[model samples]
Target: MKKTAYITGGSKGIGLGIAEALLKDGVNVAITARTQNDLNEAEKHLKTIGDAEVLVIKSDVRNLADEENAIQQVVDKWGQLDYCIANAGVGKFSSIDEMSEEDWNAVIDINVTGVFNTVKSAIPALKKSKGYIFTIASLAGTNYFEKGAAYNASKFAIVGFSQAIMLDLRSYDIKVTTIMPGSVATYFNGHTPTAADAWKIQPEDIGQMVVDLVHMNPRTLPSKVEVRPAVPPSARK
Candidate 1:
């Protein structure tokens, strides 16, 4: 039987990319996102990948019940889940003074709490399969920047949360990894990816990285990985 994976926020960008990669490798994938339209579109694209079965679920990761339902949906369809990616996240970049309460809460609720839900809900199945977990974080988790108070706080929380869980979950022979990417060329932060963003890390790069981790030796665990473009704008000058 082909391995099955569950990915949150898998309708687009890095999440979708990872699902596509895993699908191509003969891994059945179940993707969850808030919007049905995005999920439908993603499912269509994912079908072009390979023979792996694709399941698209409409779910919001911020809700624990929703997360649990999403995971249960995957398990119901596939019988077992071999991977869980807590990749649902949002960003609201603003200085402390300018950021609104709603923006702050939205970021924290989705980026931090959402991940907690995703991982927590998937733990039972993951333990059963001794699967892998990937938390898609950002460089802001470690490197703070101006006008990034909300986004920074959320990412930082996720990084710490993911690492702590890595230690907690490792005893079950389940691997956990947090991937912090610098300036990936995606729809993240409402930016339209174009040729101009080519220099930045591509979503597929991160996707392939996850695939590689899945294939790595069980004894070797790269718990935290920070990836950036080889030639950033600063370096190009």
Candidate 2:
């Protein structure tokens, strides 16, 4: 029997890439996004990849009830969840003085709280299967930048939260990993991904890493991975 993976925000970008990688490896996958249209599109695209069972769930991780429902749906279909990638995140870049409370809350709700909800909802099933949990953070989580107050805060909180959970769940044989990537060429923050941005990380790179991590021996847990461009634009210039 193939292992199962549940990925949040799996409709596009990094989440989708990871889902594709898992499917290619014969892992059953359940992906969630906020829009049904995106979910349908992802389902269609994923079907072309491999024979693994695919489930597309319309979900907003910011809502606890929705998170619970998404997890339940995956469990009902697959019977058990062997891995979860909390890849759903949002960003609003603005200086602290200009950042609205709404903007800050929105970032925090989806990045930090959303992850919490995903992990909490899946803990029981994960515990049973000794599953892995991967959280997609950012370099901004550790390196502060101008006009990145909201995004930085959320990512930083995610790093701290995931570390604590790693310790908390280790006894249960559940492995938690925090993946922090630098800039990637994705349609994030209103910018469309393009070939010009190829120098940056690709969603599939992160996805592949997740697959490798999942297959690693149980005794070796690589709990933190920081990925960045081998040579950044400034270096090229």
Where does model 2 exceed 4 Å of error?
A: none
lDDT of 1 by residue, 62-158 (tens): 8999999989999999899899998988888888888899999999999998999999999999999999999999999999999999888988998
- Give the runs in model 1 whose Cα sits over 4 Å from its true position: none
lDDT of 2 at 135: 96
**TM-score for each predicted model, relative to the true structure:** 0.98, 0.98
Q: How high is the CA lDDT of each candidate model?
A: 0.92, 0.92
TM-score of 2: 0.98
Candidate 1: the clashing residue pairs are none
Worst 10 residues of 1 by lDDT: 90-99
lDDT of 2 by residue, 1-237 (tens): 789999999999999999999999999999999989999998999999988989998889988899899899988987999998999999998888998999999999999999999999999999999889999999988999999988999999999999999999999999999999998888888889887898999999998999888888899988888999999889986
